[model samples]
Target: MKVKPWLSHLKPYPPGKTLEEILKESGSLTTIYKLNSNENPLGPSPKVIEALRKSLSEIHLYPEASYLTLRKALSEKWEVFPEEVILGNGSNEVIEFLFKAYLFEGDEIIVSEPSFLMYTKFAEIYGVNIKRVSLTGELCHDLEGILKALSPKTKMIFLDHPHNPTGQCLKRKDWEAFFQRLPKEVLVVMDEAYGEFIEDEEVPLGIEFIKKGYPVMVVRTFSKFYGLAGLRLGYGLGRKEIIQELEKVRQPFNVNLLAVKAGLSVLSDLEYQKKTRELVLTGRKFLTKALSELGFKVYPSEANFIMGDFGKRVDQIYEALLSAGIFVRPLKAYGFPTSLRITIGIEEANAKLIEVIKRTISG
Candidate 1:
């Protein structure tokens, strides 16, 4: 009876089901392939595992309150000052920090319709009105539409580069044009959660805009390419003043000790980083080509996942694949009823998934 009016209608974000849940659902423990979430199929780097093992004994002590060491490591990696970086439990937390620091009820934010669902999720939580523009014909961010949606109430614009669900990125020139039209009052949050896997030369990385003095913040995650999803460590880069403000809203010891240690060890592991990028690129192309050859329309992707429209057989195919212990993300929630977003997994998983799809389609 005491719940706020806003609380009455809220629904939680639907995270993908756990591997254990899928195993239980299918009644099979072996031969399961998980490509539903865009996770690194190669698993965490050996260095991270060793680092986490070393930190286990010191679990009694709390993590460094300021997280300075992790910040310094990120600074060295991104060529930015430590003061310009703010760490998060995950990049998702950084997004939350932005809302806490800047949002008030009745304020508005702009977002692409099919980008990261978290943008709208958080907006609704904060009672911020969201103006969502649909993607253009090529499935890229419609910069013109975004510009048209802007207004005085617009407090921020959240963009997921190499957008989630679609995996298409806006190029530098397109971004520049959009920036030129945007008013200086609108702060931009560029979520580059999967930036490292991008192989496109024309796509502009978020850090470049931050360097240009735009009121923009670039968020990066160790989750995808670093294979540290379970560790929950990510960071944001912005103008020193903006980062300092975000830092003030951050809780002390937000990042756990083991994740901090793992972040430091893996951030500089050049060999593992190289192998991760290579695996995703090679695996993405292989899966895309294979899926296309199987008579599906595979959208071009620059990230670690590809989106394919499976036509009328989507729901049937999804259930059949689930029974076969292969899990891929269905996009019905993102408003694409006939599409599934498949992560670029290991070579064997990719090959086996294709085989399963062929068998399912044939039946």
Candidate 2:
């Protein structure tokens, strides 16, 4: 059997190591801190758990094909109409919908060089040309560079705001300038996987642009701030017409029953949401200051993780942390070989990580 010509060249996405994988590798280390995947260290909301428990009985049935209840909830939250909302198994599937509905083979999409790997991966899978613009010196997306790279064939641009790996975000002015210069025909897919973690008031949410009537789709997920990674729930907000086209390509019953229940429950859990935000903001500051004090160059992050350049000691430090039952993501694939992307863990886990790093460096 013959595979597509590009199939042989495609590389699999390198996900963060699992706790099970780490424990197996570091036998006898019972206490494992998984600070790699940028998960909510505080865990899911109690309300979400209760909702899931109540939903267990419905596992045998298919979820509502339209997911209207969840969509209505999201529409209200984002101040968009239900018709403008599209849910995915994860926001990733929403991305695939764009390819299925709009992109054709040989068309082009622009992405930052070190942005989410899925954008390029999907491009490769669909045989679409990808134009990768490198990030600026400050590790933020070069909006100017992206604009310069656009061509007539460019159909879409995928930007992971509060950018993945680095967690750097653009200011409202930067976003405004980019949008002003962007072609009206091209769609902008704002992947806000980490949007809920952004504490800075200056940082603009993608939904703000959608309200202004830009051809933008803001993709968000429950996996981050809601602590529902296991549920794999995410949604996209855009103009109703754009969403309608994408909706045509979405799979029926794509989001499961429990995830829907959990999403609805969590949406109303104001207290849980507030606590999650406070934890991430405080932890982000603590880790940034702690890492910098140890002579590491920590990038300012709006997301739940920080990317610290540990100089040449990164490898040794990474290994030592692993042996000590700590797991943080190494960013070699994201092009920063000497840096580690550490998720802001709980207070105890953060302290342990700081102490472990200090000891590793001193010894």
Candidate 3:
């Protein structure tokens, strides 16, 4: 009886500190900003609340095996055929579906260094090879480098647009250039978890590539904009053939009942979607300006969070923010020890974070 020999030293995914854990260390702060995880500061849409309540009676029954309704809803939203959509428990499950559907024991996947931890984590889990390329000095994906890194054994590449930790997105020209050189044999999976928050018109969505007949899969979630992170609702869009292959390995009822209800309800709640976009955009502008004025090098972000570089004072500033009932994400685990990832929280949270940072540095 033995585990895979490769798994002996594989590290487990590190989740952020929980509220209870934060409170214990901070000695009972009365109000916590809790911006670490990039969750929508707005709670679930009102429509989702009602739908979840209505779905309570169905808890005893199994969810629809094929989850056709939710799948159909997503397909219509993206203008893809029903068979081209795959409903996943979260976008993570769909990502794993790619691994399950395609890769062999020694196959490889190319990833940006420190982009998304799960990409490398899954590759390790399946004993797939990982080829990591560092992001450009400007902190955006090095698309050219990735094309050069591919091999006959390369099965996929994962790109997280409005990329993690730093929140830098590639321009349209760069994306097109990359795709032009990419070989059709390797699939490119765009992890657009933060896609909704994009404000720049020049930043293109992965669906644009899919429509052009590229071997691309676009993974998205209802978590951020719709405030359904707790529900674990997500989906993937690709050509029907790829979607069909992935579906074969996807477990029936993978998406829970309430999540389906919440997803459909949220998609219809245009007012809620409007409010969230305004909140993120307005807060993003406010934080970027404020953080920059305070001498932090705030990068351009199309996501709901911005990355700020604090130089040698990172730990001092992080602990100070924690004491003041604010919790921003530290990027040491993402390999940027001197930077912090601050979510574009509600107006009050955004303002309070600024006030605390000002006080911390001035003192």
lDDT per residue (tens digit) for residues 1-363 in model 2:
999998789988888877678778878887888999998888889998888888898899999889999999998988779999999998788888898899999999999998899999999999999999999989899999999999999999999998999999999999999899998999999999999988889999999999998878898998999888888999999998899999999888899899999999999999999988988899999999999999999999999999999989999999998888889999998889999999998888999999999999999
Worst 10 residues of 1 by lDDT: 22-31
Off by over 4 Å in 1: none
CA lDDT scores, all candidates in order: 0.89, 0.92, 0.90
Consecutive 10-residue window with the lowest summed lDDT within model 3: 25-34
Stretches of candidate 2 above 4 Å error? none
lDDT of 1 at 346: 86
What is the number of backbone collisions in each predicted candidate, taken in the order shown? 0, 0, 0
Candidates in order, TM-scores: namely 0.97, 0.98, 0.98
Clashing residue pairs, backbone N/CA/C < 3 A, model 3? none
Winner of 1 and 3 under lDDT: 3
Clashing pairs in model 1?
none
Show the lowest summed lDDT stretch of 10 residues, model 2.
17-26
| lDDT per residue as tens, model 1, 1-363 | 597677678888888888878778877447887889898888899998888888899999999888888899889878999999999999999999999888999999999988898888888888899998999987888889989998999999999997998888878998998889899989999999999988889998999988888778999998999989888989999999888888889999999998899999998788999998999999989989988998999988888999999999899888877877789999998999999999888888888888888998887
